[model samples]
Target: MQKSLKDLKVYSSSDFPSYLPKLNALYDDLFSGGKGFRSKLIQMVSRHLSLKNEAVYLLAQTIEFIHNASLLHDDLVDRSSLRRNKTTAWLKYTPEYAVLAGDYLLARVMVNLSEFGNIRLIQYTAEMISDLLEGEWIQDSLVGEWNVTLEQLNQVHNLKTASLFKWCLRAPFVAQETYDEDIHQLLDEMGGLLGLLFQRSDDLLDFNVRNYEGKAILGDLKSGYMNSFAAFLLQDCEEALRLKFKKAQSLDEVKLLVTPDLFERRLQEFDQVNQESIDLYLHLMEQLAQALPEKEQGLRDDLIKLPHPLYWRKR
Candidate 1:
């Protein structure tokens, strides 16, 4: 039976031990006001299979725990002040508390998975976590590297962002003991494209393009990080312009350096390139439909609606 969204709670107060001081309060803040999109994705995929309700919830909670744990470490590493429009966990609680909380979540994931008795799921998740750490290390190295290319950023995105998406698509099937290599490979490719599109669209937000969310503009540039769109925009610029681009403190300063017309043009080009990716993802969906069992064909419909809204930011 397909479960309703309301029936699925990825985080519950009872899930963690109450004896740890401030841990519950910290988690209450951590899990609140966030999108929880990854957990929802897990539920969406699991519903199409013969997964029991308990198994579906476990998968959803596992992904959320892993993702939020990364965010806790990331905010501290980047010295970020805010997440989800609130003070970051590292600052709100002591940095030590934040680190411990994040580690606890990961530990709990292993405990829960072990109780569930799925060795493959536990191994796959551990590998994904390692990929995330590797990606973060590479991304930190790219800071202040003005000449970084989109290809390089994509490599980081694949490991850091796409790994989660791949798990979301593949893990539910893995839980059901479906070890079909071709299906998993196709899902992996689709997840990579989705991660690329989502990250690039988020990069566009830094430039205020379709930035309905009103994210602080030029945060990446000011932080000495050249996001995907920025790399594409400055790909062909001269050394002098690149130097000026790095010093930009505001969006207007960015526009002044690149010129308003060229900025718009580069944005259009960036969107066009990503549109091609969206098309490729849709094509893969067709192949995925053919590979899935007839009863599971409806899963494609739920997934097909993801790319356009994810990239275009127009749900």
Candidate 2:
């Protein structure tokens, strides 16, 4: 049986040099609390392709490093104080250490990929990292632009969150030297939809819709970043409510208008508008499950389970 994500060993002292004590410890602390969603996604896709466990584990580690590295940098950029319900690396450790630690992880990813001796994997991962950073920059530019449209928000999420998902689904095939263009394209679409769903679900948590792991609520609004849920809700609302939300300066001010009654109504409206996205996510997964040559129904079963609760649930 494949090891569970919790049991996957991502860090070893041998991977790091003895000189960098802060970076080493920072990685240990950051990796400990994550549920390893990215890696789990990779494992699901790999099983469908019948890839070897050794290669899957390496790809898992590589993607996890990329994901966590982004979190480290994201914490610094967002000035987030807490992550996974603990002090963020940038705050818990020095900001310099946090930045360097992110760099170290990216560097390690390259080294491992190079040792794996796959040119395509290296190229694809490099592009994914670039896409993630571009998304970060675009999101930073849009801060305080409360009138941001759903299309713009989709672009940001596609790059920032979905790029990694795209890579996770496609990388196993790349590692195995499979060049099926149609399968790769399908996986890309599936990953993109999954990323959008995951990000939007996460944004809803800011409204206290659900606390998957006790994440901070209203942090996006507090930081002047309008979340996807708020952006979608603002689109169809009355002008008075729109103006009220636009003029408010803090989370509390927004809260006054987004009362329980108003929130409930808007939540339903938000779901109504985005129902197509939810439908597409399931559709793509079903398509992939049937399209794969190997019959790994379990992979599709696990993937389906991930977003089941995110569609319409309040908690």
Q: Pick the candidate with the highest lDDT.
A: 1
The clash tally of candidate 1 reads 0
lDDT of 1 by residue, 1-315 (tens): 654557577888888887865999999999998788998999889889989888888999999999999999999988999999999999999899999999999999999999989899999999999998899899999889999999999999999998999999999999998889889999999999998998999999999988998888888888899999999999989999999999988888999899999999999899999999999999999999999999899899999999999999964
True-structure RMSD for candidate 2: 2.9
lDDT of each: 0.91, 0.82
- What C-alpha lDDT does candidate 1 achieve relative to the native structure? 0.91
Candidate 1, pairs of clashing residues: none
TM-score of 1: 0.97
Position 215, candidate 1: lDDT: 88
Count of steric clashes across candidates, in order = 0, 0
Candidate 1 local lDDT, residue 145:
95
